[model samples]
Target: MSQRSYRTAIVGTGAIATAHARAVRAATDRADLVAAVDIDVDRARAFAETWGVPRSFASLSELLLEEKVDVVHICTPPQQHAGLAIECLAAGVTAVVEKPPTLSLAELDELVAAESRSTAHMATIFQHRFGSGAVRLRRMAAEGELGRPLLATCDTQWYRDEAYFAVPWRGKWENEGGGPTMGHGIHQFDLLLSVLGPWEEVTAVAARRARPTETEDVSMALVTFESGVVASVVNSVVSPRETSVLRFDYENATVELEHLYGYTDKNWTVTPAPGHDGLVDRWAADTVSVPSGHDAQLAAVYDALDAGEAPPVTLAETRRTMEFVAALYASAFTGERVRCGQIGADSPFAKRMDGTGTPWGKVTAQ
Candidate 1:
């Protein structure tokens, strides 16, 4: 790794921004949190003071002109991701953007095109993939030690009330994208896809359920992967007993993780089949504890940059995950199965997630 310390800045002083600040600070030997930016100048100043960042700005333009930053962490809402990431790429600075990296596939394509022309690249914050248990599971699957994957389930059942959607951008199709499926469940499902590989087809259904929002409060889908693994996915903001759960049932054993948000090694459990009990020793031996969060991911990101390699959760990987999201929405809205690469430039879902407008009537109330 190069010994050079990366100068980093964070945009958006929201709740997630504090996590980014801490992650940057945690990697202090390799990165310096030089600046913080937010549309609210007071929040920006307060964030900088709290994080001990040297500077604060009200806009990306001001931050870029004033400081020489090597990397930018974009903690802004879904709608602003593409524009801000594009700006960072154009300025020859790497961008580490939050989940639901762009509002739509078309916007993501624009960011991808911008990255191709610049030395800088963009990585989405799919922090679950950085966890040690997830990494080990992925490695085992790749090595065939986990045996043939058969069935898997990913559930992101969390409750969000009217107060949560009271925020201006919380529930709109144009701003926050599509409720729980896009924002909440993307984390667990991204980890699922990382293990299962490419998905082939998806059939889904969505409903407004209990939330007062323009987007669906709950969605369920059946996903068929190229590896012959069939997975059931549920994304919801209406569940009273909130949990983020993923279970993979392979021929040899069943690997499962049960956690609300972030998870450590303790959150994972393995149940080997009758003849595969020996696999337990292997799992126990490879115990490297790393939780799923921005700190773990940011450390890996800086390390990749130092080695002149594409960071984890590259734009291509993120694109696949986002496309899967679009496919889910398309399938749910149109009542038809959507396949991989089916939603392209001409597809309605590509342009907008609500897809030819919501079939269940538009949400008038906030």
Candidate 2:
């Protein structure tokens, strides 16, 4: 903790690991990219070379043995996240895991249990919440500048063809963790939860409708937040016109965000209600132009780590977001509304998102 700059290692050599490395590189004052690890050593070395990392190893244990790292970026698949993160956490290395953080709530709980006994911590990558637009929105709402949030809509609609799921992990229940809702829509809905606070209940429906995947490719939910705000949520990978959108209708204004993947201040639109026009100028001044990406979030993470505090997207918050995902699936499959804290350790949904034993029945990969 006394180090001026943390030594960071990336524990996966996939496409997203490059982003993690670059984010670390961007904040040279707080962190240094020291190593890369992958089961595939060749890929790990190439990744290390591209990122100017000093070391590469075939496994995290090897990397830990060879280098003293303060932080680890877990950019591996959903199935491998908990194992790598648990190992890193036990070694007192803060782990920044990519989402869907685990394949099941049980697995995520294992991570929480590991962190409970470790000096270090684990944070999930929900970078959408770090964007300037999102920050401004939350600030405005908190200060009552946006008035009481009434209704909202969260949508993550994009296209991923059959070929895209050809990868062993892309569209499987056990691997990717339940299609678009779990992998893709999670970012948007997490942003919604960030803005609206605790969600009270969810009534959802999911369908395999088009994708040849074992899990649902499309899902819709009605989320009721604790504050009585109702949100319409949709996660789809079948839409050809790709877009991620969230709209908040407040007593004083209507604020919206629309972008494909990541977003910035420009992607936001704010409109004040009648006689509340002062918010127009305030909104513009409030937006400071930080884009939503790994870099913005990592800067905050290091800031917390340097202060010996837990990082952003704390596991408690992560559990809340993840719990909503489980509840949505439970509701979808059970044909019943799910409420906050309803999926206990005894519930099957707590064990797996598809724990209701396949909603539509007998879905096989085509």
Candidate 3:
């Protein structure tokens, strides 16, 4: 639908930046990778050359000043997402930011406020939500075909060794926000939130268990959704057996998705309850195969842009996911139930993921 291909630019030349470039290449009919930017000019130049992009710059300011880039992908660290997104919003350019979108609820609120003042938009990369399986499940839930959702479970169990955190910005609260709950688990859980509408409350507990980091290495939560659904959530980076799993049990069927990083239609399975075996045929009617990845989400983003509207995973929607993150952290730290919209601007949790301070004291070898 986009008559003119969007001249897109990527601002970070890190590991995840390649996925963004590949996504741009995947949507060649809708977008063009016109420029690359990084703090390391040589790295940016090499990335642009490798990706066949036209230009490279040492910083976003230089790229913004020189190129008419329509969309900028912020693939930098968690602390940098808000600033870069705000700059893009102010410059009248659309920004697609990698998660966790910001370091705190306050920063996300800032980006949301900035978007209200700009014509351009801010979108977060929750790619798993765009896959065919998730879409079908959400449609069924919406149409009341899945029956009353009763129970659910979401888990993001992945391994991250000490060497992985030695990169200077991997585990610190000031850098990556929280541990797996903020960085790694947010992907699958955001997909869960996408299907389950709004959450009512969270009661969580986190521990420093293994990692010698400033934040918790593992977290567990009990979440209650507004739809009368109760779900248990777990996030960890210390598990030897790495797996990302989600299971939804409705009155008529049980739907499950099992994958490590990404999922295809093949990774999803549906089991009908007694006397509801007919629903299997209905679920089988959807045969589309959109895998969970940046390409699929970016394709959808371009479609929204083409339709003269803000992109998918926009600020309004991201706020809900982020507030969930905040609530989980608040409940984990304070030993009390945290509800939706409870952590306002006055709350310390709004300022940082660890709030005023963490129970772990300092980053000592534990």
Candidate 4:
């Protein structure tokens, strides 16, 4: 049987929307960018023209009404993700949403319910997980070549100035969900969760040290996984020297990835333990290099759609990652260690990230 080609549309003409369009264009064989949607008609038209999309609409409803879209990339703000995704799923169109999929676990639950009622599925964009280095690390770990993971560290310490947060939605808890933890660090930590599996508990601290936002500018957490691997997670937007780094210490070797934003195979390093030096040859011999970015993940999504299967970064996987975000906030604000499954339907953290309210007293005037 021949593989089916997907007609994809992007809803939102922001900067990230262009990345989605480029990724769609790159996978010419399996997907085509047919339309673009945005509240600003001019912006939509401009984006459509630049990306070679045939049509542009001012709203998702209008685009859905006219275009034969098989997949819709929800690239709007975090606030609109749940509603837009639910609408697409109701129409039997798969949704590919960006990170921090929804503002809260409750909202994500709604998306999950919508998916259950429709033939379509929803996937969040955690592009790092699709990178070849990540793929290789996971394969080695599974094969017992890396041995048992004992310790890990994930740091997303990127710098964002006051002007960046001056945008209405940038740093607000009610709008963009949370600060660096939700918007930036999510990618690296989601990759961490992908490799480590289920988490058992989390103890965290969040503070607004510099930025003039409603959310924390810096946050740190100690996460314990069910496999007994412990990890230190740091999310900060105030650092001058920005870096996205993840290191895993296993029984036989130490693996590290040092890069900002995205990574290729070259960014990864595997150092075998003194007694296990022979494993170094095995690592060097396994040659596969694919960069981490939208293109890699979009290709996987289109392939899954062609096969009539759930796409990469499935809703269930995203939910766990989002739940971890919730646990981080819950532990940070309440000054209590939070366990997995602790933030259920009744938990305030499930309803809103700042459910218990900001731990820091008030945002002092700049």
Candidate 5:
């Protein structure tokens, strides 16, 4: 709110907290890193020292009460996101929280309610949406270059060893929500819903082949979009090589995105269909392409903030994503097809998981 740049505070000092620190430091004149916080004082001090931040706090209340923070980057895990973000909003500090914004739809709904009652600018940190390929795909879809998207597919394959789950909250349902689907696959899931619009229904099944958790290690779903497009989502934490890809089949041609950190070409292959030469010609004539990524989206955030407009990834947009995950979980639990936009605040799935222990421990090593 000051011309002196947006004073910022990062509320968690884990690995992601460091990345947010770098992002804050990397932000242009639009934002500044003012402080860092963690429940662990030493960790907070280490992050503050590393980032050259002048302030450190053991809790959000201390930072809110002491720091002149305009924005808060919530780098905590999913279960911790809702409360901190609500506090930040109530403190009149804008917030950019990490993805899978909350552990359940109910938590997310409460967050939305809190944000609605506040004037703070709130957004989810879906950095993948800021990536170049994602931006391009969204633009094409908007311009109708991808006409009446008929089919969509997402494949996310990443490995997570036993040690990766050693963290106290890593594999538990109450803390982490679900395994790959809710934790790792969340970004891709958000991107998919963003580019493809809303899903009409989802039928999913999950497996625990790799990790020891009540949550699934591998999962796949058939998503039917409201536009009559059918999509498949494949998420796993035990693939040999990491790969995240999205493919869309439209009336005129096919569009694909390779979701890597620094994607260069962001290839969009346009092949004229049997009788759709005119559509191909139109795309060839009007389509303008460029290299894009998280930087592009981040720039958009700064611009929106400067212009006093809402951030592109608003709470409303993210709520649908939470619903998507909620539906997937509901479908998995009830063994029935789950419809989107139907889970209510009083839904049984609203409650947190048992958080007892990792489900992968149940099976002996092969």
Candidate 6:
């Protein structure tokens, strides 16, 4: 890294912001949390005092002008990501934005464009990619040790109540982008795309089985990878208990990662394809380990800075992830198979956030 310490500012003081701060402190010898900003001045000040930040700002603009920060960790909600990230880029500050990045593909594109025009590098937090188990799976798949891939599946089910939706923008399409799909599902969906490669097409169905929100609590999508491997993704906020799982079926072997913190694989199964018992045995002998979600990603960022290279997760990759999200929405809404590249400029879901008052099940598909 540069000899000078990196002056860092956290722009949101929520629970996740605290997690990011701790991760930063653990990961970077050269990074210092100089400021914390929140719309609520009292919360900002409290966070600053607790975290030992030198300053706190009531507004991001104030923080940008006064804090002299070199990097910003944006922990704001999904709706606020685009505007704040764009503003930071415009002001010549590199930023690490929270996941989902924005509520729509159009906003994601604008942020990408802004980053390209600025000297400051930008990245999104797809922290699951940093897990050692995830890395091993990707590596094994790439090395063809798993042989031809047949199919993949991701299941994410978690519980959230009306109280959770009491947060002002939690249920709104304009704010959260969608309920479980963008919020709960994006994590594993991003991981799936990371391991399986780019998606070719998608068709989906969604519903609000229980949550009192304006977005779906349950959604299922059929995705086809560019390599012709098919996958099924299921996301839900109505399950009694929380669980996340990913399974991969290959011609030579079947691999699986099933864990509560889906990112960390404490349990894995690799079934050998007939004569490939040796390969499976070798993989089984090799251990997989990694820091938890936030820590691993932060450490990776520190490493990139140390090596004078871009962060592990780039804006282009984030944009592609967002496009996948857009295609899911398109498929869910239109009841037709939508191609990945087709979710470009003219896509209906682009910049279209109809925050109608009706709950998810009541809103007719457009």
- Superposed Cα deviation of residue 200, candidate 6 (Å): 0.3
Global lDDT of model 6: 0.82
lDDT of 1 by residue, 63-135 (tens): 9999999999999988999999999999999999998899898899998899999899899999999999999
Candidate 2 lDDT by residue in tens digits, 1-366: 553688888988999987887888899777888888999989998988887778899999998888999999999888889899999988999999999899888988999999999999898999999988888889889988888999999999999999998888878887877888899999999999999999999999999889878889999999999899999999999999999999999999999999998998888998889999999899987637899999999988988887888999999999999999999999999999999999999899999899867755654322
lDDT of 6 by residue, 1-366 (tens): 455467899998998898889987875666888899999999999999988888889888998877688789999888898899999999988889997788887888898799889878788888888888778888988998888889999998888888999999897787888878898888888988998898899998777787777787888999999899999999998888888888899988888877665445566678888898887667766675774488888777766766777676888788778887777777777777989788657656776532222234454554
List model 3 lDDT by residue over 1-366, tens digit each: 536699999999999999999999988778889999999889999998999988999889999999998999999888889999999999999999999999998999898899999999999999999999999999999999989999999999999999998999888999998899999999988999999999999999989889878889999999999999999999999999999999999999999999999999889899999999988899889878899999999988888888989999988889899899999989988999999989999999999989867777643425
Per-model tally of clashing residue pairs: 0, 0, 0, 0, 11, 1
Report the Cα lDDT for residue 114, model 2.
97
| Worst window of 10 by summed lDDT in candidate 3 | 357-366
Q: Please give the RMSD of candidate 4 to the true structure.
A: 1.6
Each prediction's TM-score versus the true structure: 0.98, 0.97, 0.98, 0.98, 0.89, 0.93
Question: Per-residue alpha-carbon lDDT of model 4 for 1-366, expressed as tens digits?
Answer: 357788999998899997898898888778888899999999999998888888999999998898888999999988999999999999999999997899999999999899999999999999999999899899989999988999999999999999998888888888888988999999999999999999999999999999888899999999999999999999999999999999999999999999999999899998999799877787778777789999999988877877889998899999999999999999999999999999989999999998778856443432
Off by over 4 Å in 2: 1-3, 363-366
The 10 consecutive residues of candidate 2 with the worst lDDT sum are 357-366
Model 1 deviation from native, Cα RMSD in Å? 1.6
**Clash pairs, model 1 backbone:** none
For every candidate structure, what is the RMSD over all alpha carbons to the true structure, in angstroms?
1.6, 1.7, 1.5, 1.6, 3.6, 2.5
